[model samples]
Target: MPTALAIAAFSPSVLLDVATTVRAADLRDWDIRTVPATSSPQVFGDLADGAVDAALTSPDNVLLYAGPADNPLGRMLDLVVPVTVDRGLDLSLWARPGLGALVDLDAPVLAVDVTASGYALAAFALLAQRGWTRDRLNVVSLGATPKRRAALIAGACDLTILNAGNELLAHAQGATRIASVDELGPYLGSVLCRSAHLDGERAGGVAAVGQALTATASEILAGEHDDLVTASAQRLLGLAPALADAYLTVLRSPAAGLVGDGRADPAAVRTLVDLRGASDLRRGVDVLSAAGIH
Candidate 1:
């Protein structure tokens, strides 16, 4: 019988490379279930309650949920990141059509998964670069990237950060990208996380999944999986050929895409901490070490 594992995330497309590799390996028969999440809190809550085995989530979420700070769940949960995922899949702030330039929108509404998370901080920083502060706009807590994209196209939110192919879809719908997360310095977009309270068998499963994902990332960076990745992007993200190729370009970028080694970069973690203004909350905790990422 195959071991079943449920992994939650905003977009399952991010797991395309590893899922195919894992299936091909067949070293361990594993039923990897991809559970779609609408928000970080739902994912983390599922993780905390053991409804899900792991989550591909924002690294800053690991920092906040595991640290002394209050997360959206209202209480801290013991979480560990077994592996760092992508750098940033073109994470950027975008505006609806007819809004040109950062200054063109008058009192624009900003949509975010949550105001206190990493992406939101990046959005605020991008806006700050143009002298637009948080108070300058109406910020609403719209869940996840897809929801935000829908809101953006529906004219519900004038500005929001999107990535992982959501931005491409938004652009296809006539949205304009204002600034990339690259403008914010070193950034880690995602990590594979799970509760630290797993049993022996479950822990081993998580480790195996992490190793497989890491190997897949290494292969991707080495240019060994270009065709597979491109096809996966097209199938998983519903992206056209050109956009799928563009996403592949991002996945292959060492600067802004997949972390080939599965190791967390201290500088990137620091970037997330600095952006969230929670350096003080992270005191005495070796963020990477605590997350089992040496």
Candidate 2:
């Protein structure tokens, strides 16, 4: 049976990396049923329930679900990360183009789902850096990057964070990036994770996918095969030529890309934990290791 892979964002940041890595592994025959990125609950919950073999999601989801305090599902299931997708934070805070400066940004609304999303936590940190409180902007709970992107473009919300193909699309639409998570330093973005309950063929499939993802990260970091990268972004994320180009430019840069060895940076993971106000969670390191990254 083909391994079922659910993606939270389903963008090139993921699709291209998977495709390149799988191709490098010569696992072309590997059948993977792709479920589009949706709300984290629906996707990660499926993994927790064993409905899906594995998924690509933020480390925040993994930690939140693994933790004792906020795990809504009651019983905590081990979310094993087989590979790390992005080592550095690949997010940008964008707003309507008309604003002259960050001060002119009277953005009364910040469109992001604060419910169980690490990006939302990072958004709050960015706001603090700018001397603004969470109350400064009315946070709108919206799932999926495209929905958030649309909200920012339509001025439904004055600001939101975007990454990968979504960031390029937002930029092309005149949503200017005012601040980036990169500036904040070391934010773990995404990972390929699975439940500890997986075994037999399921476990083998997870390993294969992890190997492919690791290979994909290596190729991306090497920054070769521009055409392949661009095509994958366009096909998977439905980005226009210009947007695809922009995505590639960023992907090839040293600022951000895949985590070449699938090992999650401890500092980066720690940064996320601190941002989420879960610093006292001592077992976090063990949890991060269970995800196959440390």
Candidate 3:
């Protein structure tokens, strides 16, 4: 029997992409697992508790978990980021049907995770760019993308950031994307985080995982797995064929999709630091190199 490789993540596409890549790599002996973590904290918790081997999370989480401060776990994790799944910002803030203008958004009561969540960090950055702050808006601590989507439709919140195939569904529902993380400088969106617990020959699996992810990314960038990817979008995200195609378009774009070579670039690292507004966290080339982000 093969060892189970479990990964905690948020986006449906990342899970699907990893599965596709793993299959393509002929790693039939490995039993892959994915848990859609309610929030970044949950993802980290799962990792710490030995419930999951690795995670697909942001660089901010990497820093905080491996840090000197601001970690929810209150301890440092020896995380190795060998590859980045999505190179671009897949997050987009969607508004209800009547909300066509930015100024029109009021109280806002935006539906997203707590201040520590990845969505909250990116949302805060966008809001700050618009001369707004987190204190000004009421952000609810919601978990899971489906709940957020339902909350938006039910008028529970004024806005929320949707990623991967979620944005496609939001578009189909007549909700408009008022803002995007794309406007912000290089967001290091999602990367492959591996546990340092594995030793000897077991540790080699991390490199295999990275190579599989890189292969998948190359297929996505080259549009080689359109049917498979589109089918995945439909099944995993409940997206229609047209919406799946739209998601595929984003996935295939050289600017908006996965990292082709599996290495996390330094510029994206700098952007992630700026996006989190954590300049004092001892971030730079050296830190990234130490974290296996290069």
Candidate 4:
């Protein structure tokens, strides 16, 4: 057996399919390890602590690992290739049916997947658009998409940002989408990467992995993956067959978006940095240049 490689992922339709396909494939020196951690910190911790050889992560997190602020492990991680240029990873600001727009959310508490995650990114982006600051809301860290949805339905949150199947289910339960985060521009969701320390020796292997992911993307886009996609959704997310079908409907739809080349778009990076107002995420970056993504 080759080295066991752990790939962190979410429960979205596309990702579920990707994970299944990746696991089924017989890749060299890589006994596909699937680590199911949804938040940025948890994923990063696994990656930094050497628990995972590589992972599927966000572009923003890549930049943060390369940045110099509080991270003692800065510049140690690197993105080997991007899974896609666009994603269904849009954030939905949902409120109860009778509640007003996102602007009218007066609930005592708001929930996000994490303080520094896609949910927060989407929430803050929308708030900036509405001229509201973080201080205006009682923000709570709610773990993952499913948890956020549960909080919303239980009335534990006045508003919540949800993605993947949760957003669709929430809508069915009368949660109205008042605002969207994907519209904010350049929200790159998942990625495949190799650590900087191994890049020199494992470049070829990493590239091969990217090619495999591209193949998986093509297979799904060709519509030959309906069964695989649905099965994976049911396996990974525990979603009902009907709900899994709905999630796949959206994933294969134009709105789900896909980028098969595995290269991050520089424009996407700039947009994320600008949106977060944390341009310093790339303060001392130099390796991104070698990847030709910057």
Candidate 5:
């Protein structure tokens, strides 16, 4: 029997589908353990330390890898494939209605998950789209969606970036959606990858998992697995009747759901690269590869 491996995920929706397929195919028979987590940094750390075999992480991790700043692990890790287009709460720029456009927020405090989180990247992209430079905004690291929302409501921030169920709630509460990361286009949200150990020793299993994710995404896009999607929403997202339905609606849409090529959508790839380039997260290194049906 092979040893089990750890797999990190942020949301229940992402893990539910992959977990279901892994179980259904008896992936455990090959001696693999799946450990799901919410934090990307933790997952990345686990991957570097061999605590986890692979992870589903944002493209920002790629920026962390190919960077001008020093990364923890030098050159052992690489993204084997991008399994899904995670348009979920891709981060929306919001203000307290009548605050004028986002570009005018010169020195405005903007709430975010973290400086390195995907939400932050989206926020930067929003600023760029609004024709504002980095010096124009006072970026505040409020952490998590709940915190960001609280900051927004308590007037701790003039503007904020939110993701996931939080975005829906914010919109319902009258937070004006000045921009959506999706509007700028597709940026890489999550990916299927592993550390040097699994990348070398258990490459086949890793690829198998990626393949399963690709197939599941295809099924979702084709409406062949509506039950799986709904169940995933109910189980993982804890969404009520209305929100869950809406999420499913977006998930099934062409602009949001899985691409037909069993890889990332090209627009999303370009969006990510374009956004990253606009932001000062990296100096000049092209962080991600173009969309390919791996």
Candidate 6:
């Protein structure tokens, strides 16, 4: 019988590379399951409770939950990131249709997964660049990217940050891209993580999964799987041909895409830390090193 592995993430859209990785890693015997998450806290909570075997989440989340930070869970959980998934998914800030300039919206509502999540922090940093402070905007915690994107399209929220094909879907609905996370410097979008308390066998399974993902990323960067990626983007993400091609382009980008070798870059982790303004958390712990990133 196959060992079951449940991987939780915010987005329901599947990545083609993940399927390819499973095959390449000979994990055919592993019953890999993708669980959709409504919020970051829920994902981490499940991870901490051993309800989920692994998670695709942000590095900042690893920092916040792994130690005594003011996380929504209100307690420390021993978590670790084994592999970085993507650079930033081309994460960008967007405005509802006809929202006008960034400076024109009066107390516009900003939707986010959570107040302190990495994407939200990036949105705040980008808005600050345009002289918009957090106090000036009506920030709402809407849970996940898809929820935020829905709220943006329905005019429930005036602005939000979106990516991982959510931005493309929002753009198709007439949303306007206002700013890119690239403005924030080096950034990591997602990581494959699990509780640090896993037993020997499960821990080895997680490591193998990470290696498989890294191999898939390497193949993607090497231009060995363009057609498969494009098709998967279309089928899984519901992106149009042009948009799917664009998604592929983003995936192949060295600056803001896949981590290729699975190792989390120290500079990217530093950017995440700086964006969150939790420099004190870095005092005793090198998050990158702790996450198995050299």
Residue by residue across 1-294, what tens digits does model 6's lDDT show?
Answer: 878778888875345345445365467656677888888899998988888888888777887776565789998777667777888888999999878876666898999999978888999999999899989999999998888998999999999999998899999999999999988888889888888787767777777677777777787788777778888788877889999989888888888888777777788877887887765665313545555453
For model 2, the local distance difference test gives 0.70
Backbone clash numbers for all candidates listed: 0, 1, 0, 1, 6, 0
Model 2, 31-53: lDDT tens per residue?
66666666777666788777777
Q: Model 3, 1-294: lDDT tens per residue?
A: 777777776766543454545464466656667777788778877776667777777766776676655577776666667777675435788886567566766667788865676567778778778876877888787876767877777777788887767777777777778788777766666777765665534446555666677777786676577777778878877888888788788776666677777666777777766666655556333435453333
Off by over 4 Å in 1: 16-18, 283-285, 289-294
- List pairs with backbone clashes in candidate 3: none
TM-score for all models, in order of appearance: 0.93, 0.88, 0.89, 0.80, 0.75, 0.94
Query: How high is the CA lDDT of each candidate model?
Result: 0.80, 0.70, 0.69, 0.62, 0.60, 0.80
Question: Which pairs of residues clash in candidate 2, taking residues 3 or more apart in a chain or in different chains?
Answer: 81-291
Q: Given candidate 3, what's the lDDT at residue 283?
A: 38
Which pairs of residues clash in candidate 5, taking residues 3 or more apart in a chain or in different chains? 3-31, 4-32, 4-33, 5-33, 89-164, 186-268
Please identify model 3 stretches exceeding 4 Å from their true place: 14-25, 100-106, 199-202, 283-294
Off by over 4 Å in 4: 12-25, 71-82, 96-108, 198-208, 253-255, 283-294
Q: lDDT value for candidate 5? A: 0.60
Model 2, stretches more than 4 Å misplaced? 1-29, 72-75, 99-107, 290-294
Q: Estimate the Cα RMSD of every predicted model relative to the unseen true structure.
A: 1.9, 2.7, 2.6, 3.7, 4.3, 2.0
